[model samples]
Target: MKKRLLILPLLVITVLLAGCIGDGTKNMEQQTELKGVLKLDGSTTVYPIAKTAAEEFMKLHPAVTIDVQQSSTGEGLVKFLAGETDISDATRAPKDNEYAEAQRKGMKLHMTVISNDAVGIIVHTSNPVSDLTTAQLKAIYFDGTITDWSQLTNGTKKGKINIYNTDPKISGTAELFNTKIAGSADKPYVAGTTIIHPTPKMIPTIKDDPDGLAYTPVNWINNEVKMVKVNGVAPTQKTILDTSYLLSRKMYMITDGAPKGLNREFISYILSGDGQSIVQKEGFIPVT
Candidate 1:
């Protein structure tokens, strides 16, 4: 991913201008021709955007092929470093150890920011708790200082808390939650916790478990679960963009080095019109 890549003028086809008034077949006639199979994996959170991009991109360049997989960020980076992937979608930057390993292997990694996202603190809809301070979030998720809902609700909702989180070992979202909110990842997690994988499942798990306290990507929030405020700020698009929400963070697409050839073109395409549109529709804040 290169700096200024997003703003780089795309090879805008006049057919796209014609699309405002043309039929589908007319737009197809003007598709840019590129040939290659792009392999993208990692960050199930980013899969929605990447998958949609791949589908739409292939439609334009019929000869180009793409395969996208929804694995955790760490898992994707593992394959990326091992030469198994063309790009790794991530919710957080590579860890220091990963950069060191890349240096040892003489691999130069490049990062391109794609969109904005936030870790959403959530609980079952039936729960009365609505807000959690950063201190309280850390206390509940990492320090074991707060375990029961009664501690936050003043005995009005008295129950032992059931905590849920994606495994920090494999999830960038979880790592972001622990490192950003909890302030560290080395500490031991408290007991009575259910560790999930892939982040999105935290939704249904918390939705069904009335006493659960959990965090997940904001995109996953639905009517089944209730999102909790961090400090006094709700995780809304405006709040994420202004970064008034403490948990907001950027989404990234990583490459082995400064991208070139089909890779560069594909990444550049994402930063442009159609790609950014997909990002916003997929529940991410467009970087553009």
Candidate 2:
């Protein structure tokens, strides 16, 4: 009877110990399994890098979900200030008013520079003009002084310039072009410039029209259009990195504040060597 009693106690202890061990193992698994949703929005110009990074990140952490949206930089800032997104991709830093609004909402904005790219002056592939001086660019885009292709010093063609402007209200590309190349926002595009949205849209329209001229992120440059040299400097990776390219700008990922938890992890991944490699692969100059 004493043996039976001792055996019963041992068996109870064994079962209880087994249950505890199993629970510990399960808890460990739960802790290691990254399971959550991460939201990212903004900057169609930065969308390629963001999308590539998000895809690679989700592969390593299949349980985690990442949602990336290609709203313009302005819209992304709006969403970030409104608390609609976890991160905002931007082609430029937030404006003063944007920072003021975030302060009013008691949110601290943190900006991370991820990559560098230039606003390329693109013309149809057949256009003979290969390089433009800054003065000529300002004249063409800002002062409406050069409206015909023949007006260029090297020009051999005689068509009226078909200018395409990115939507200044939303596109950072347009805003940067206006600020850097055109000299100021007040100078404005010559009256009749066609306004395009999403940057890439300018590609097809310009490709179809031989006389078209537009500015877009260098990554979007393809054989369909010829990227003109600005002030005798091409928007190559070397020039962009060296700051010799006149229109170079830093791309960013903005958070409400210093990121925490999964947000921190994801941003770390983006700044990692692998992430920077992806940025280069996508034709943008990696910040690292």
Candidate 3:
């Protein structure tokens, strides 16, 4: 008698789709026959969140595939408009000319707000500064006018401020600061001879230098560094969600027009409870 080898078939399951955007598949844990590849690119900041969403989504719908890539937000929109990708991960909202360009191609863009990121203007715990206006922020980070803490007009922690900034080339928070406060990263901060480094040591630097000032993700701000307000609004979840925080920006996933099929399902998963949890895990403020 010959020995027989038995091979089990790979995947066999019923499809159970969830209700509404952000519901995901919690209602039904079974696998789906859903198949096809989804391509997404842009915004390194949003890359992690999007990638995680793709990974978890594919787990449930094993037949489906999702590809996520990272680039500048502007570049991502360009690719999205060119039909190179199914979705674009963006750290900022769709720009006016981008919308126009999409219209020129006879396609209207649809935006889905996935998360919010805010750059907290941090200072030493000893610093008495409380808030900074947007214009004052430009003067400090862009124009480099207010070199000393005494010029802040908020309170008295008078000293020569040791300005520290993260390089925009590698720091998403820096890039965001450039666009939101500095107006242009290309012509940023000519006002002072400041120390420039990456984000890892920002808190330590500020901790050591009593008169230090810098910016980092709102979440990074803790007992070590005091997070000051922008335009009298503190960088908090409520302020970020309300757009009251000046340095706050929304992260988005865009489609050529309305998202459908895989595009729709993928984004919906991200907006769902499971997906929003991923957003929080990635250091982003969840929108829902």
Q: Which candidate tops TM-score?
A: 2
lDDT of 3 by residue, 206-247 (tens): 888888888876655668888888888887788888888878
Candidates sorted by TM-score, best first? 2, 1, 3
lDDT winner: 2
Q: Flag the better candidate by TM-score, 1 or 3.
A: 1
Q: How well does candidate 1 match the true structure in TM-score terms?
A: 0.87
If both were scored by TM-score, which would come out higher, candidate 1 or candidate 2?
2
Each prediction's TM-score versus the true structure? 0.87, 0.90, 0.68
Name the weakest run of 10 consecutive residues (lDDT summed) in model 2.
181-190
Residue 178 error for model 3, in Å? Answer: 5.8
Clashes of each: 0, 0, 1
Give every collision pair in model 3. 22-272
Candidate 1, residue 196: the lDDT equals 86
Model 3 scores a C-alpha lDDT of 0.77
Cα miss at 36, model 3 (Å)? 1.8
**Per-residue lDDT of candidate 2, residues 1-288 (tens digit):** 999999999999999999999999999998988879988899998999999899999999999999999989999999989988999999988888899999999999999888888899999999999998888888888788899999984467989999898776678888888888767644577788898888988889889999999988889889888898988898887888888988999999999889888888888998999999999999888888
User: What ranges in model 3 sit over 4 Å off?
Assistant: 1-32, 124-130, 150-212, 219-226
